[model samples]
Target chain A: MHTNEKTVAKILFIVAVLCGLSALSLADVVAGNGPSPLIIFDGSKDFSTSSVEFGTVYRGPVHFTHGRHINEHAVSCGKCHHDDSGEPINDLEFGDGVDTCTDCHYEETLLRGKALEGMSQEEVIEHYPNAMHELCISCHKEMNNKTHTLSAPEACRSCHGVKK
Target chain B: MQKKNSKNMKNGVSRREFMRFLGLTTGAAAGSLLLQAPGLAAESSGATLPKFKIHTLNSTAEKIYKCKPGIKRFNEANMAFKQVGKEIGQPFFHPLAANLKKNVANSEIGSGIKVDSPDEARMHLAFSMGAGTWNNMFGPYGEGKENQGLLSWNPLYVPKDLAAHPLHDPNAVDLTKKIKQMSRIYGADMTGVAKLNRKWVYSKTCRNMYDASPARTKPMVFSDVKTPRETDGELVIPESVTNAIVFVVGMPRASLQLSPSSTQTMGGTGMGYGRMGLTAVALAEAIRSLGYNAIPCMNDTGLSVPMAIDAGLGQLGRLGYLVTPWFGPHVRIGKVLTDMPLVADRPIDFGVTEYCETCGICARECPSGAISADRERSYTPPASAGSCSNPGALKWHVDGKKCLRWWMESGNGCSRCMDVCPYTRMTWTDNYDGNPDPDKFWDLNLAPFGYQSVKY
Candidate 1:
């Protein structure tokens, strides 16, 4: 194949895999549908692991860790996330770089899209101290389901501590 | 005609031809053209957004104070009152203390310090405040106490009845306006209005009064605190007249960080206070002139803290002090409460809470360790009721006792806590040589401004 053709084929292959994983994750919600719509990617994982393009930002590759969620944690995708039809929301793709929670979530649209509603902007900013607690507690609770794990409260100071 | 049509079909569409095609469908042209610059289109339509950065200190340091907890005692080594006693033998030399002394001395000689011009007086006052009362080092804070052996104040303090002076009346209107105008004319940077919050007032037992003409000394007393007379309480001022126009006279941050001497810092505060006094006096006279009530006071009438806070100048910081964004805790405050109807500003919350949460550098730098080390909680102090505690209301309160002790030990009084405050430090940019350059010339003039600039 010509080099251009090969590059195009590779891109198509990655996109197909990302789409398939997203569909599988949302299999329960859109079980009867033609394809699941949401695509999830963990950027920190792969970039930290292998070399990738530099100087140009890229939306993280969608690595569907379906087995970990379904087999290990037994999380049915519906419990944690949702897949809907439309231009992808929350995760805006610009060239390549993906903006994270601190982006739009800083001053505007924190916990956007109905996850949290009716909170004043100040209250949402204050949410970090408590929201972080819940995230850690939930993860830890799940991990120590069978054995003892860290029992500390998940307050910001509980882990981050005070700065002098 | 057939040949010409064939030739036309054979040639590709020119720029003009493309424009002609674009005229056929507006939406299609826009859609296809937008594809050429996806990033620009995304930005314009609000698809791309900028991320924010979190300001925080070292994680381990934070954990030490919050998680790995122990009995956190308030450090009391840096007390100012105590420092006055230790430094008594030294020249009553604070620039502010000295400046005040000169006025008092002028009063003593029966020849008040005369000025050829307002500018000269201003320069003299600024110099006196910065250098302190000439060779006379004993200051107002410690002079009356027997332990200090400092007797005889400059003639200025001799006028114990300035509040009751025949030339003045709290109800004067013209006087109040004059005071306000005079204060700004003299050099106050910001002013505000608030009803006095009595909760911050120190009881009579906490202070002493000096009456020099009769050569009589008496313990300070407030009849309202002791007798609780209705007239004593209400006649002080009605809620309407309870309005106080607060003053924020800027201090040079540079001198503060130099850590020169208690005298130096006091000079800055003293100059501000002197200006505040002049304004209050003028304002009271103005009010009297206008046939209204005005209470002109630099230090004694009521508490200054809450009034300043309510005036919307700045938020109280973790150090248990007002932290103005422009000058931080580097400036001194005073006010004139009158029946003057003026507009009030709104309270601001500009991420100080988050900034303080992640940064407890003040608590660490506090010489007396008076600042709380943990998250805010409720507690009552022994001295006064209604007087707010440091932690309960989502604030970091400094332990005044520990802070006081440090002031005593430092001799000149320690502002290390205020001195090290990040807010006190000016923000600056690094030049090519990695040296910080203050964004403004005013910053270069002050030591703290320059110090903070470099540190940043």
Candidate 2:
């Protein structure tokens, strides 16, 4: 009876944790999104590491140097920034509202993946990391879809230096 | 204009008709009178050029290289800039971007910076090559804001005097000498001429020929020429082109001598391209001023290497670069196709093929192992088709596919093989062809013929 009670408590605790994460994401969705800075995750410092590593099967941290992208490269700010809806937020400039990408992507609920009263349990699981995978990666695909060579990093360790 | 074989065809539309079509010949009241001249074909205005037998194709390069219609747009070949942005993601673009932009914004001379660590340094180099190089010059040119690059490549509003005039020097020898002299004056390191082999010309221009032909003149019925007319996205060249005048522009040998993956390495290559564009424009205008319709072109519409070889500029080296006796492989080539009468230079037999039989330095030094280390030049590229090589020729081919892939990885156009080439080091920096020795052509048989032995 004691072991059974402990098992029930652990399951309840995990449920509570999942619930807490969803609630925070819901709050972020209500606030909406603006912009983000370039982030590098080496798997050591606890940033919101994805259940999938950069949207892959492995869970490694990605290395991205922001100074090169925004300032050095001419890809333009509009390529990354977007509102909660599919609408793009093209008004953002260099270094404007720059912060952690996970501040909104990992915590906020993307408007596209909203839950309704009649939705299934799988619908609820569409949260932070899923939204990132949909947005940033697809943009890269759209840019290089017509070319011959693989322009964007689609593999596991391309952006993420290694497992660590 | 073309001379010697410029026989006026009896029923063809004359240049007068073309001028009238361009609206330059406003006084067309004479009607059929201008068209009735029987002996008009005998006049000096005929734009035909004499065909000289090109002796340069007598080498192994000729036996291997086959002529094709044309090449596809190098959009795929030019994907080096875009691939890095996506593979590494946007974050890699900016932090390295700021430093790269700042470095170029200053006068781009010398090895610019030394970063904190090797990683940071690499990131900086990547961003610089992707975003900071002088790639601003190579693009389509048109009216107003779109004409951000070289306009000479396009046929916009040209004066009548410039396009249709009597050849300034009717003598082919004097004209060739003056033209070569003027080429060097406009920054070409070496210049040579040849009877243009039509096989070398693109049967049809690949897409993106920019529709800048004279037929596309606006406000005239000939405006169709301004728009590139492609049967199926393939551009075609008119048959008027007869003589091929090609020139070589030297790169800063010191920069390429640095490490291949370094910023200085790529910066030098980029700088050469930008400089070549300028030289081509200047050379084209000089030819035009001499009363010839010269079409200035770079690595477009045809094969530059083969054309350079046919023009007696240099022989093909092991690494596929045109190894001029003076600068070796450290040069960029440009050319102007014209009808102006000029003497063709015979191809030199300096024994580059025999030397390549023993030398394997470039292939061994290649970072991506793209070059073949074999002693013999094959009829086809030694590397497979997937390695970025176009099949059709047999030569000591480098794996261009791997070469491009390496460039994508290094964040710069890798010139690692060029760094250690012994020939690039022996460049004779002079005002003209410095080696005027009668036996300069005989040094190929010698194991090591030091220039110090001969009077400088």
Candidate 3:
């Protein structure tokens, strides 16, 4: 009876470890080497997670839900994560060590107005803020319009805290 | 007049026919004619002149200066000066009245008291003295009362022969360039031509601050007159004067950074006003030399912010000042109204509206809480603020009474809003830490005339 109980206990411990691993994998899938569940997009050069680490910021750092977009929204990884040929990487999975958005869209400042006047749409998306804003804002706007509810934020103040 | 007639003949359009087409015979078609006259004049000039290089970072003229759907143009009589003067029972003829009173009350050797140190007082006096020298010598209104100074409506020193035979450049494009170049040579840091918006022009000039008597105010009229004249009952600006050459004179950045009670701050503000007078007078004289009827103005004839916006100098910020991309609010505006045909510049929008929407630094940092901190803009001023604000335009209405009261109590003008603005720094790389040390100002090398070179 004692031997049978020990064997059952070992099996239960394995199952619990497996469940924890699955949860971590799901969280890591969209984290992109940053903090899990929530990612702070602050355009830091040294990849500092703290928003206050920077000297001055034009706007408040965007607090993005990484896990919620993946698990709740059921959004495909390929929708935002893409390869060099501008093609989505459909096979991207957990612990894949994906590149950050700023790694490719590397401009320090967001160029708008006359600066983007003559540039092609593809060229204009290369700026860091442009790329992120286009992806996030467009999706949020689409979701809001489709649902006929403001579940998603579409205005500047909704995403970034008012700077004082 | 003869040159204009000859040019009209060369363009194959008779003056009478052109006038008829313009509906100028009615003498009531000022605004619409003024709007359409530039393009018509350019077409008659008979040359496809190269477009002037756009100097601004971005221009969206159509999007700016549009009153909200239900709003109307603001009346000039309700402007801050007139309103404040009525409340205080004193004619607020000049901006320096409060500062002068403070000087006498404090019994300070200089124009402003230095609560911090003697260096601050000396710096304030040095800048104020320079500015006062120019502003006092030239008429504050730039009306050239009795042809006394350089701000004269009529050319003071230009030869009579030159004034009689105006330059007959039918090509407005070339003329526009020439006028802009002349303006720069005459000490304008930035120059732009904009077709005058009639709504900005005052319906009547306030002759006396508190008096509503007919003799105390003069109607600003557009008439068949060939030149701008100040008659006993009216200030007649000719209908031919359709364009305004607006320019900017930037103040010293170092001095402005020390604001909200510092004498050094007053120094910078004083210097900017002084330079504005000098530039406006010089540019007006140059325009007159070209045989055009030019009236130099420094904050007197019409509102400067709207005219500057129309001229593409800058956008209006929450502080109720022209926040230029180059100099931010640390600049003074000057203008010359003329009949000279010139291509008007499109107004610019360089993200000031968007940035100001999110950033309420100026309001938060304001010593008197004069600036509005509301997230949305409104057409009406706050009820508690009273009639100091002219409330027809859509904007963040600042409380002029509260602002002036602070100025009086502080013993000098406060520019806390101007100093704390993000645009004032023109970059987000450096953190601003309140007023900088005034003692260090004497140690740093500065540009000639105490202005900073354009950084961005």
Candidate 4:
């Protein structure tokens, strides 16, 4: 009835508004720079494979061994790669090559949308590694039943730091 | 915490304690407490109200859980981020789009999607005021025909299961069984129980009297604001009604499959809505018949999620929908909260997380991108419940605001994602091979019929 009473009500409404928005599910994984980018590995286009002979130099499209990962982890393709529609940042403009996992799984993004809403590409890439680790490790623990691997190496070098 | 009342009015203690006391046995004690502490009692007697003062964030909190500006104008604004080719009034339409949008509009915002903003608000107000709306499509059976016969005049009374009646008297058991049985007869697909957890009840959303006597927190004429508590800031269970019987009514599979295609989609959703109304009426009437207080709810009042979870109806899933074993996310929920005692169901964990991770179809297909991309890292999923920001919880909390916006923006209430959810598919079959035998279960009659029956 009073001005103060109305103000208090407004503040309470604001808080509820914030809480309601964040109440669905928390984003814990990082996509590109924030949450781990959900990788959409197009088995047809995204990857190429090779059985290289000892002295042959293989300079081909950046072909990841899509079959090896699925067979080794006993994972259905949907786990690591989802259909393009589920990308956390719908504007990624990448039809099938999107890989921001943390965008949907990061605690902040899960509560909020992609954190780097208007940031540059470089800024996101800077925070990408930590976000990826947090995202991947958490899934590893909660979803160990599905995957054979016990843990992902903490170091970024483990998965990305390889050179033949 | 409840404030005290009475200064040794009944005992050697202060007047506040007597009024604030939470152990009162009758109306006389409440009257005395109020008389002893006029400030604590305020405009009414101490014997009527609860111990706490009621306050809502704003008038809007009474409207949408998230007080988003867009929510206030939800019908007017097309808030979704649409792709280039998918503009409004396009020649080539997304076949399922129209139906899905209408369904979303009916449930989330209510009324048709393009209803003028003010008219939409009026429609919402009408329903809220119990005036009912044309789009409401269903109403309590006895309330009026304006409700489209969604509910029965005499609620479906399920006699409580006597074996689990909490009362010591043997007669109460018969009454309980009567209530439970009648609920099934009224078409409740499944039902179960859990104790009335007071915490799930709303603390201050509606009008109520809180007797300051600190002696008892019991409400006297608390009728309007009946919902399961989750915002009590504490998960307190009421001493009375130690059980909750939750029910689910399945929607037609044919209609749901044609989601986003306005006409066909409404049948599925309408049935679901009708089921909720029907169930609520039945449960409430059944409880009332037993001479116990019961509240029937189709959508308004207490939080349904926790009650559903505790009642063992379903588990929270990745798309933020209740995933029940029998119907997945395809069924509609309606509940009746009562003081009647009954047996409780256990919480189930049937590899929803595993399934969600392997089948990211719902999250992918979400046009508004509300479904969470992450799997459950720990036991909980981050909250994605409200408007812009997702609530940080243990499961995928869809951004209801974004989802609603997309529905409006697309000019068709959308259930594309719900349609695509692997869980939404009817897994139940007579074959018993743990899979639907496509030949028998997947009706081929759908495709041709659906294609031919377009009014738009």
lDDT of 3 at B76: 50
lDDT at position B87, candidate 3: 47
By how many angstroms RMSD does model 1 differ from the true structure?
32.8
Model 2 chain B: lowest-lDDT 10 consecutive positions: B34-43
lDDT of 4 by residue, B1-456 (tens): 011212212234344643443132223123212111001111121122112111111121112122223222111011112111122222111212332233334542221223334444334223222211211444321111211143322223222231112333426455545555555545555565656555444432221111111111122123333222322232222345445667765554544453332233333454455546655664565454434545565543345555676665556666766666545676666677666655555544445556665455565445445565544322222233222232223345565544543433332334545565544442321111111222232343322212111111
Error of 1 at B397 (Å): 2.5
By TM-score, the candidates rank as 3, 2, 4, 1
True contacts kept of 1: 0.00
TM-score of 3: 0.59
Better of 3 and 4 by TM-score: 3
Query: Model 1 Cα displacement at B34 (Å)?
Result: 57
For B1-456, candidate 3 gives per-residue lDDT tens digits of: 676745544465445654563353123212112211000112222333222111343343324644655443344556554565454443332223333334434544222233354444544555544544555555443321322366667877554445545665458888877766655545565677888876667666655433222224566778999887877677788899999999876666666666654555556666666667766776676666567898888766777888888887778887778876545676778888989888887676555665565666666555545676655566768654675566667677788655654443344456767776755554211122243444555665554555432222
lDDT of all predictions: 0.35, 0.44, 0.56, 0.38
Candidate 2 residues B1-456, lDDT tens each? 344323322123366764554353222212211211011111121223222111233442343344233423223222222233333343222312232333334422112234445554444344334322332354211111111245343333444444445453489888887777656555565677877775555432322221112112111011124222223333333355578888776665444544443454555565455445555665566665455656666655456777788777667787878876545677777777776788876565445665555655566455545666555555454423342444455466766544544444333345655554444533321211211222232232211111111222
B1-456, model 1: which lDDT tens digit per residue?
545533443353455754554353233223212111001111222222322221222222112123223322111111222222222321112211232233333421001223344444344334434433311232222222211212111112212222122232233344334444444443344554444444333332122322102112222222323111123222223344546677664444433443312323334444444444444444444443333445555444444555666655455676666665445565556665555554443343334555555455565544334565443322322121112232223345445533432332222334555555555542111111111121222234223212222222
Off by over 4 Å in 4: A1-122, A125-164, B1-177, B203-242, B377-392, B426-456
How far off is residue A77 in model 1, in Å?
70
Docking class of 3: incorrect
TM-score of each: 0.40, 0.50, 0.59, 0.44
